[model samples]
Target: MEAWIRLSIFVAVLALMLVWEAKRPKRSGRVNRWHRWRSHLGLIVTSSVLMRLVVPLGLTGIALWASEHDWGAFNQFELPLWLAVMVSMIALDLVLYWQHRLFHRVPWLWRLHRVHHADPDFDVTTGVRFHPIEMILSLAIKAATILILGVPATAVLIFEIILNACSLFNHGNVQLPTKLEAGVRKVLITQELHRIHHSSVKRETNSNYGFSVVWWDWLFGSYTDQSRAGSDNVDIGLREFREEQRNTPFWTLLLLPFKDK
Candidate 1:
């Protein structure tokens, strides 16, 4: 059921991307690098499948291993199902908010995270362009969260769905009316807010790091409410990475954190 939902969302996002690209004005005079776009699309599809399989498997394996050792901590938690789901989602988002901020603040982690930032274009595909290594690290974080917080698997599933859905929505190219965007931005992260994070300016790129809720950015003082340069006027890609490295294959992207770029 989860897999089907994911697939449906992916297809819808791809269709949206096509429309966005088609409607985008050519006045900026920047040529649409079709080959690079295709490569990025391929990476998104591949990484989505890999992450969907690996993350759940990794979590389940850890759960089974802990069960064998009589570490029944997750089962021991007696919270009501609804409370468990709500608390787990909130707790996970809090952790993710800080973790994402850390990736920008800490240079070492930024090396790994820069792969996602190196895209010269920002669209729906950009949301899923994370390195596989980063996904593995995220899974480790999830395992730790489950062990420490005793989060139910069902809550984890719900959070995953919410996270994925919001990611696609924010990275998407859909435009919203100014008043509507302002209202939504108060509670949720919107495309306008997230697009600023992809701006060429380091200051803008560092703000609005929340994956779903906008509250974290507000609470942490990372919130930037201003609109960015129009998508065409905005520059993407990291200053530290070479242009050639931006198109590196999956294996190279996986090993980028260790390599001296």
Candidate 2:
């Protein structure tokens, strides 16, 4: 059921991206690089498979291992079902907020994260452009959180759905009406909010690290509004690694962090 929902959402998002790309004004000097499209497709398909299938299988093993262990911490806290789920979501966001910040602030960690930033264009596909190593590390953190918090699998599933949906929504190049954007920003992170985070400027990229909720950034003092012109004017991608890397295959991208540039 969840798999169908994810696939439907992915298709909807891809359709929206195609429409937006078609409507967007063409730049005279900037030629469309059609070859990169294959790499982008490869990235999205690979990540979708990993997140929707491979990670879940691995997580089942981790859950089984955790069940056999005497992890008293998982049972330490007791709360109402609603409260427990809420707290678990917030805790996950908090961890993600810091993890994202660290990816920008720490040079070594940035190498793994750079795969995401290396995209020449920003779109829905770019949202899933994370290195596989980074995804594994992220999964490990999530597994640890589940073990420590004893969060329900249902809560994890709900949160994952919301996270993926919002990620695709925000990463797509859809321009919202001012009134709509204002309303959405009050509750969810909109594309305007996330685009600033993808700015070429390190400082901008370091802010707005929250995935689903905007409040994490607000609470952590990393939130930045894109109302200002300069906030959205910056370029994207790392200056040092700006050369096109579309030639790099899936295996190479998987092993990127370990390889010398």
Candidate 3:
């Protein structure tokens, strides 16, 4: 049931973003949409399969197990269910925000992370384009977080759904109206901010790492208000990965971390 809920929401958001980008793109297309989508979708599918096989119980399952064994902070003490859920979600988001920063600051991790950044375009599909090993590592981190926090299964479900939706929404090629974007981004990381994160420029790429909330970047001082080249003209993807054929293939992404350049 939890798997079905997550899957249904993921498909719905993905389809909506695809249609939104088709009708109202923020930037002109840079690469063949079909080619990029094929590779991006392939990565997500492969990652999902590997995740299921590696951790069949999933995060919610881990949370449930922790609760059963009274194995985490929340379980050891008493808190209102609502408070527990809210605190758990916030804590999980905070840890993930730091996790994202760690990936960029650490060299070996960046090798794994660059696969997501190596996309030659910024679009909804790019949101899901991550190396499978990175995905596994990410799951491990979240599981460890769950074990430590005793996060409620409900909170885990809600956070996972929200995180997936936010990724699709912010990575979208379609932009909100200027006024709307300004207002929305005060709380959420809108496409305007996320596009800067995908910029080929090193400084811009390193900033705006938050996927869901805008606060983490602001608090961490990694927030870049505008792209140096201007948001409309921001160069997406890694500067070194200009060759689409080399960067967009599944095999290439799988082996990218091992390559020097």
Candidate 4:
């Protein structure tokens, strides 16, 4: 039931992004949407299957186990359920912020993380393009966080769903009015902010690492206001993935993390 609800939101957000991008693209003709979507969608499907099979006991189950065993911080405390839920969600986001940073800074992990930055374009589909290994490792880390923090299953589900929805929104090519974007980004990561993370320039690539909440980047001094290159001129994707055909097929994306740059 939880999986179904998340899946439903994912599909709805994807559909909305596809239509919105068609009407107001951030960059003109940067993406071969047909080819890229196939590969990105393939990555999503592959990662989802691998995670379901390998990590059958997801965060909610972990949360339940931890609660029943009284095995975590919140379980040990006498806080209100609402307070527990809110604190857990905020703390989880902080953990994810550092997790994303470590993936970028660490060599072995960067090899997998780069598969995501290796795309030639940014869009809603690009949001779901992660290597199976990265996804599994992320799942493990999240499970550990849930256990340590005693995050409720409902809060975990809410975080997961919001992460999915926000990633799609921030990765989409849909352009928002400048004023509107400025306001929205104050609370959530807007597409403009996320696009900087996908820039070909190494400096821009390392900045704005936040996924859902932009506050982490702002507080960590990694907040980048714009692409070093102008929005229209910003080159998307990693510098090494210059070959246009690298992202066209599903198999290529699967093997990408192992390929030499």
Predictions in order: lDDT:
0.71, 0.68, 0.91, 0.86
Which candidate comes out best when scored by TM-score? 3
Model 4 vs. true fold: TM: 0.96
How far is 175's C-alpha from truth in model 4 (Å)?
A: 1.3
Error of 4 at 11 (Å): 1.0
TM-score against native, each model: 0.80, 0.80, 0.98, 0.96
**Model 1: per-residue Cα lDDT over 185-217, one tens digit each:** 999998878888877689999999999999999
Clashing pairs in 2: 200-235
- In candidate 2, what are the lDDT values of residues 158-246, reduced to their tens digit? 67777777777777756677799899987788878887787777777778888878888888898998734463354655655555454
Better of 2 and 4 by TM-score: 4
Measured on C-alpha atoms, candidate 3 has an lDDT of: 0.91
Error of 1 at 172 (Å): 1.4
Ordered list by lDDT, greatest first = 3, 4, 1, 2
Pick by lDDT: 3 or 4, better one: 3
Which runs of model 3 end up more than 4 angstroms from their true locations? 244-247
Return the clash pairs for model 1, or none.
Answer: none
Per-residue error (Å), model 1, residue 9: 3.9
Q: In model 2, where do residues sit more than 4 Å from their true spots?
A: 1-5, 16-34, 47-78, 227-232, 245-261
Better of 2 and 3 by lDDT: 3
In the predicted model 4, the residue pairs found to clash are none
Model 1, runs deviating above 4 Å: 13-33, 45-75, 227-232, 240-242, 245-261
List where candidate 4 sits over 4 angstroms from the true fold: 244-247
